[model samples]
Target: MQTALLFPGQGSQYIGMGQDLFTRSIVARRTFEEASEILGYSVSNLCFQGSEADLTRTDYAQPCILTVGIAAFRVLVERMEREPVYLAGHSLGEITALTASGALHFADAVRLVRFRGMLMRDAQKHKAGSMMAVHGLTPQVIEKECLEPEYRGLVVISNLNSSRQTVVSGQVNALTKIKERFTDLGGHVTPLQVDGAFHSPFMKNAAMQLYDELRLIPFHSMRYSVLSNVTALPYPNVNCIPSFLSEQMVERVRWQGCVQFLMERQVYNLIEVGPGSVLSNMLRREKLDACMIQSMDKKEYLQKLIKESLPKGNRAVSYAHYLKAALCAKNYNIHGETSNYLKEVAGPFRELEQLARSGDVADGNAKALEALNHILDCKMTPAIQRGGILSHIAEEGVVRHV
Candidate 1:
């Protein structure tokens, strides 16, 4: 069955979120290291060891969560053999989805989100605003009440989270008034613990700055369809992604609508591929059987997808190429020079490619498969090898060395 990958945004991060993946997967560690070099601060430190206050800072939080989310995603791809049929991310996660789909390169995504966070933080300096979650009400009711003239001060619906859950953001006074009104109307109102009025006009300045920054980044055509937060629809074209992302800063996250869009497309299996079960919880509330990435039964789930996604029949050469591609992708993600231990396994990787193209189908397949097994089993450092999270081989029920 086809699946859709859901990535969470801010408020989903916590200490040690992706540490397990980083410890277990070479590709995950490389992603963290690459981001650390780009930002000149240890993203791994911020995610794994930083104080809650430090992580909550807009500038720090965006990059930290993005890095962790992407790290988990990379590790997920390495562990599983399936490709997602569609992608959707909440707020900052939209960028993550783009990065995962090849629309934005990893390095470019790290830089862009850092700048985006800075701009949003600066916007808060001049405009003091707040966000509140209004539950037990539909979008129409919340939007109508927000527009009522009595509690006027720039309040607008910020996130359409679900049919019965919507968030509002704007000036504090306006939000307070709306909260009181919603409570009196029997709606549950919980003020969000955010520093700025995100997804509202208060973010106009940040939106403009983000737009300017987006122009400098090259967004390639998406490999998988990504539902846009601003439009609540699949992006018409990749070229439009920049503009949509720019508007996303001040546009309500039409999450409910995005979910509806996915549902209309028959996406029943929605797997959230990042930290926290927030998105999965939200989807479950919508009666969808959504699953999170870091489950205890991850190996079983990973194996099932791998069996489906792996090429079949005469695709032996194609499978060989996939292994090489995975290796090269991991290579680009490495922080410093290749380690001598990894270098020791490079010969087998090279041989796999050679054997695949040698035109002897039977011998080539056997050699390529054997070479892959050797490469995956090659040893590295003791520290890298001994981790709480170990990749598994379903067939042998043994820990994979990769």
Candidate 2:
């Protein structure tokens, strides 16, 4: 079966969620433990025993959900001997897929996620923005209604979850206005339990922070053809991924595009590797093929999809994957003397940083890193390995090695 792994983002999290798997499977427990070591906090405690309020914090939620997704992914890898033909995720979930596809280390992925949440959270400035799901109609109708002219720039379809279902986000006035439009447009609207508007320009500042994070953090080439939320296709060029990820924050998430692309590519089996059924539900609705949609919330998906997602060679390892333990045998750095684009990345990032000043510290860190990397112009591995002046850049967020 040509399989694809789908990861769910923030809204999928729930209290006392991943405990069952952590308790029952050694693979699951090891993954969680390793994540705790990387993050410098008790991630497992938050996922297993923490209250909703504690786990729901932006910083915590990013890493927490990723750890669970990774934990489940590890178990799947242990059981399955081969990787899938495709991979994707919704919102923050896309980062999870990027990590799984060798574009990032699990530790760095979690850190970036923590910052992703914090920065995005601060960008809001507490205007009481929120999201709601509208179903039972075509995206065309929903868009026309939710995006009526009077509510211009107010209510926008944030998460295009599927062809028939999308989540709208924005101000209260805009949302109420959009809901009326949805009602008139023959679409059903259900207010989501979320607290902020995401995926719209209102979250533009958060997207700016995410752009910064994209710069500072490194991205690697995909082991397989993974869909980009920015373009809804295999990343056009690995070198241009920073912009793609940065824009994904404020740009419309082309989830329907991802599903359609995978389906057209003949991927019959799609796995949702996370803590909920949300992504899977969307896939079933969007793709009518005998689409074997599975989720990490259940044991079956963990066992089945991991087998489907990993390649013949890159399976579970005999060692723990802590950042310190996982460095390359040779110390290599790009030294920033090679490319001009590395320098060009600065302009956009500086713009993002200006927008992020009132936001979280993590937001600043993310943007600054993006600018630094753009100046270096290579994948993170070489961009950060350079010494002297460039070594200064690597220390932005890295936990130093002794």
Candidate 3:
């Protein structure tokens, strides 16, 4: 199936977000550890045990969310055989998408986002703005209202989440007036848990500072296409990455457009690889019923993917059977020492046979190679004889099956 990966932004974060991925997958654990080492703090601790108040801070939340998104993506890479055709993120998630696409090194991306978060927080202290989600309103109506004489120059639509939902960001007073206006027009308004009016003119200074940070970091060619939140299109070239990323802070997130573009390309499998199901819920709201959507927010979801990706049918069993027969046919005691044969070859082969019978392809395949090593290590077996057995096993697809 053609798949696209979507990463969630700041509001998706919470206490104990990535704890499951951290505990269950070594790749995920290493990703968190690597971020912790680079940031000089335990990202795992923050995601798995930090308080909600601390996690809500832009400086902390941005990095924490980025770490979790990338951790889950890494675990997915380790477990699944298929690769996504496109990648996209909501807000701070765009950075996560970039890191996962290999356009930005994980270490550099971590420090850059921490710096970006600090800049945004500083901007919030200076300007003091907020964001509110306006539901049951079309983008055109919200845009028209923002351009009115009283609300104009005060608030702007910051997020085009869907046909039914839009987010506005601006000064506190302006947002209050806009919220009242929107509510009177039968629109439901809910305040977002954000520090400043992100993706609006209030973040211009932060965006400029972020541009300088982006300049210092080197961006590589992406392994897969990544859609920009600012343009809702695939990045045209590597040179535009820094400018487009910086511009994203001050431009509305065209998430609805991004999803539409994916649908146009016939990409049906949408996987949200992050801390929460916010993106998945958003897609559902868009009413893309024909698409298969999934969220890797918990360990159970990751386990499901792993199970589905396992080799199917009797190929694994057949390989296991062939190996067992070969091992039994081989004489481990060419030197006439039966004790070495019993300890080395017999024990490991028995374990491999049990794994094969259990029908766990991954484990059985792993144990088969390990058992082969044991068989080759028997001191009583002649070196020439061992080579002959190894060649025969290779011919039987032992290595290829794995």
- Pick by lDDT: 2 or 3, better one: 3
* lDDT, model 3, position 140: 87
Worst 10 residues of 1 by lDDT: 380-389
Task: Write model 3 residue lDDT over 203-289, tens digit each, in one string.
Answer: 898899899889988765566689999899999877888899899999999999999999999999999999989999989888897
Which pairs clash in model 1? Answer: none
Tens-digit lDDT string for candidate 1 (1-402): 566788888877777777766765556677788899999998888888998888777898889878877776655554443557788999999999888776786889999999998888888886788788888987788878877787544889899999768999988877877788888888999876567889988888789888888988866556568989988888877788779999999989999988888788777667777777778777777666443323311445444543443332332234445354336432222222346436646787778567657644332243444455335333311112212112311222322222
- The residue-level lDDT of candidate 3 at 42 comes to 93
Q: Alpha-carbon error at 106 in model 2, in Å? A: 1.3
Provide the clashing-pair count of each candidate structure.
0, 20, 0
Error of 1 at 135 (Å): 0.7
TM agreement with the true structure for every prediction: 0.75, 0.72, 0.77
Per-residue alpha-carbon lDDT of model 2 for 233-321, expressed as tens digits? 88665566677777877788888888888888888777777787878776666657677777768766544543342233322221111
Ten-residue stretch with the least lDDT total in model 2: 317-326
lDDT of 2 at 296: 67
- All models, RMSD in angstroms: 9.5, 12.7, 12.6
